[model samples]
Target: MPHLTIEYSPNLGDFPEADMALALNASVCASPEVKDESDLKTRFVRTRHFQIGTADTPRAFVHAQLRLLAGRSPKAKQDLSERIAAVLRRMAPRPDGTLVQLSVEIVDMDRPSYVKESLG
Candidate 1:
């Protein structure tokens, strides 16, 4: 776990982002590359107008982007993505009137570097 961006609809309410971050960190730590929890970084963004018309009322959608700074492997990325997705799915509310959607994308740091220092 290095950097994780969790984007969701503003309708999610004022939930505990910190708790989510911690859970994500713990999940990543289960991986080999995530040797230290200190190396993890996380961010949550709640935006409005992120609706799914196909779904019924009371909809909720969430997109998660996870960037790993170490131990970049295809298996690792797949595993992490699935794990994160599962976690988010369980944590997210149901689409009673709210259509709940969740997706997770994992990025490997070994290739295509995009760190702050590299950006310059």
Candidate 2:
């Protein structure tokens, strides 16, 4: 299973969370390294209190943390990270004066320690 968490500064203004989730899910599923699209889970967290570069001016950032099962090669992970950043950057809102930064981090989970159960 792959879990993606998005954290952003609320000062960036209203964000289309649903659209972002859908777009990110599609991006994650596009990668061949991801085994199942159904196993992907995504969520967004908005931060109200955050400082950027010690500046009082308005600055926005979108940070995505992706967690996947351990096994993928370093190159695969790097590619996935780049793809994710591209998708996010394309969708991120950039106001005339606000500086927006997009970033992604990929983390591997220990297969033995990771557990999942679904009942339908």
Candidate 3:
């Protein structure tokens, strides 16, 4: 199972959360470890108030955390993270004069402790 959460600064203008989620889900599902695309879940959150250290310069950021059930090799995790980072970079908007930093982190969820339910 893959759970993704993308947090972005509010100043990032007309953020396309839905489109980003679609792209990210596709990227994650491409992995051999992922059994089905429907198993991937993503949600976006906007940070209403954030600060970039002491720098007053116009800066923004979009950070994504991808959580997966533990057991994958290190290389697999790294590659999966890299794929997501590339997708985030492509989707992130380069606003005029705004320093935007995009990043992704891969978190391993305890497989035994994780639970999911699919209901109709």
Candidate 4:
């Protein structure tokens, strides 16, 4: 199972979080790193109070943390992250002079410690 958590600054007004999630899921589904698309879990968390650089300068950021069970190759991980970043760049528009930053972080979870039981 791969759980994707998307965090972003609150300044991203009218952000296409849902659409971005769908696009991301589709991208991941096409990757060889994942077994199935249905196993993906995604959510977005908006940062209400935060600052980057000068207080007056307009800045916004979207960070995606993807957690997966250990055992994937380093190349696969990098590919996934890069694919995600590309998607973010295409989906998340950068406002003029907003200094928007998009990043993706891949986290490897201990396979033995990770537990899950899907209910149908």
* Model 3: residue 26 alpha-carbon error in angstroms: 1.3
Distance from true location, Cα of 89 in model 2, Å: 1.1
lDDT of each: 0.75, 0.88, 0.89, 0.89
lDDT of 2: 0.88
Clashes per candidate, residues 3 or more apart or on different chains: 8, 0, 0, 0
Which candidate ranks first by TM-score, i.e. highest? 3
Candidate 4 lDDT, 11-72, residue by residue in tens: 87778988999998998878888888888888989987988877888899999999999899
Off-target runs (Cα >4 Å) in candidate 4 are none
**Which candidate model has the greater TM-score, 2 or 4?**
4
Candidate 2 lDDT over residue span 1-120, tens digit each: 999999999877778789989988898899998778899999999997888898588788999999999999999999889878987888887877988988899999999989898887
What candidate 1 gets wrong by more than 4 Å, as runs, is 53-58, 69-71, 110-120
Which residue ranges in model 3 land beyond 4 Å of their true spot?
none
| Candidate 3 global lDDT | 0.89
State the displacement of the C-alpha of residue 79, model 2, in Å, after optimal TM-score superposition.
Answer: 1.5
lDDT of each residue in 58-115, candidate 3, tens digit only: 9999999989988999999998898789888999888999999888898999988788
Error of 3 at 20 (Å): 1.4
